[model samples]
Target: MRKILIITGNYGEGHKQAANALYKVIQLRQLNYEPIIIDFMEVTHPLLNPISHYIFINGIKMFPSIYGFFYRKTRAANSMSEILNKINNLGVSRLLKTIKEVEPSVIVSTFPLAAGAVSRLKEHGYIDVPTVTVITDHTYHSSWIHDNTDRYIISSEYVKEDLQSLGVPKEKIAVTGIPIRPEFCHNLSVDPLRTKHGINPSIPVVLIMGGGVGIIGDGSTTIRALENLPKKVQIIVVCGYNDKLKKQLSRELSNSKHEVILLGHVDYIHELMAISDMLITKPGGLTTSEAVASELPMLLFKPLPGQEQDNAKLLTDLGVAFQAKNTKEMIEVLSFSLFTPEILNKMRGNAKKIHRKWAAFEALDVIDEVQNATSSHGTPMEMNS
Candidate 1:
């Protein structure tokens, strides 16, 4: 069986999630191909990976300004960003070894660092395998671009234009909405999901997600603000992996006027999303993509600088979501949406227009196209090797 090596990282969940989405679709549909998913950092830097990952997660939380500063500085392919991209090429030798071991028909990268590494390999004429970079965010960051990458799987036409402005050929980019889990791609009956979750079908259900680190806002400020909305609504807060935040919210919202369901990390986020009318999230690429897939309108919280901000801009520009700078703005947006159901319906319509529910399948088709085109050139290996 032919293999597809999917490289991802754990610095953030989006990268890993995007990679997993592709792996899942390939497993479910492509019987002739085997999908191999590997955490690039783990294989490349086994010892320092964990420490660096810890620093990365905390660095964004403790000093978002600093992170945003760097993110902005590196948005374009300047000398500084190029130098950083070269620094990201640290594990090329190990990566090349893995490439040889796996002998994947095509290589896919969901993490920019891994993309840089693979691009370096192809640049230096070490590997002839076709490479596809699935950008996990809607923003145009120079880090995700490389001279040797054969194709770019991007989120939308906005991202396509952003990349084209950076000098990447438009033909080289495919606007496949960021790959989300297959479950979110399908339409489920909302009444059944609401009943299953014991949610009131009569009131609006707002699903709140802060990504895995729970970076929504200070403790329960956002929740309290939501509870105080003039219209009574059911709030489902998914505090992913943040035990402290979960416990704090549990204590604080125990007696909320509106029904508040507080949960820790959950695997059934798609189900929760299906039942909700609106999503208040951090605007991470994966979460927003899932929301769009569910046709759920969104009120993005004060997004951190960098990709979160960029993602927020894209969603709002597309008319599928609203951005709130703080709790006050959050309340305002929530109240307005609650009072105006038509606006929510319009947003859902916009979401339907752009949402690529089968993005993973579409990405697989791109991979197949690239592989076939490469085979036609007779450069690397045989198709049935």
Candidate 2:
């Protein structure tokens, strides 16, 4: 049986979520292949995991200016590439030893760290596997591209242009939408989903998500804006892993005329998406893809700097979502959107236009291509540095 290694990191939920979606698709195809999923951070240098996570999460939260400085520095010509190569080579002996044992025919990376690690292994002649990168964001950064990757799976056609501008060959990139769970593609009637969630079918339902972290600092502001709307709307606020935020939202909206359902870490996001009329979220790639698949329009609020900002622009350009910089603007946008059926319908239509109904299946097809290329050539492919 052929083996494919799917590598991701826990720095953010998008990479892991994208990796999991690809894993499920490959497994369901039953293609006489074994798929192994690994968190690269966990496997490579355990001592660095906590430090890396802290630097990523808290660095963004507490010191965004510093984070932006580092982010910008890393994007300079070959700066990030050199840094990653050095780190990958630092643990070469251990990493090579691990790869020797696992013997994967193909390597798929959802995180930049994995791509860098695999590139190092290939450069050192330790592994001959075909390497493919599924960029877990709508935009491409220099860090995401490595010299040793064979192909790139990206989210939008616009990203294809971005990669092209960065000197990546057009042939090496495929716009596969963003890989989301197959459940998002499943057809669930809105009425049934509303009934299941105990939501009123007559009133429009809005889903407010702050990604996996559960709470964005702007949650209160967003809630207040929604509360100001003239129409009584049902709001389902998912505060992922943040109990304090859940309680706060519940307490704040307790006596309001609008129905506010406060939840913490729910598994059935697809059901919620199915029932929701629209989404108010920060534009992480995976969440955006899921929203599109559910045919739910979005009002993106206060995207964190870097990739999210890029994602927001792409969604806005596609006419699938709106960006609101502050609470008052957010409320005005929502009020106008909710009251105008044509606007909502147009946004939904645009979302469907860009939606890849078979993203998971298409990703599996790319895996098959890699497998065919590996089998027929029996030679390791090289990516230009």
Identify the candidate with maximal lDDT.
Answer: 1
Residue by residue across 307-348, what tens digits does model 2's lDDT show?
878889989999999998778888889898976889999999
Q: How accurate is candidate 2 locally (lDDT)?
A: 0.81
**Candidate 2: which stretches are off by over 4 Å?**
84-93, 376-385
TM-scores of the models, in the order given: 0.94, 0.92
Can you give the lDDT of residue 201 in candidate 2? 84
lDDT of 1 by residue, 339-376 (tens): 68799899999999989999988999999888878763
- Cα-based lDDT for every prediction: 0.86, 0.81
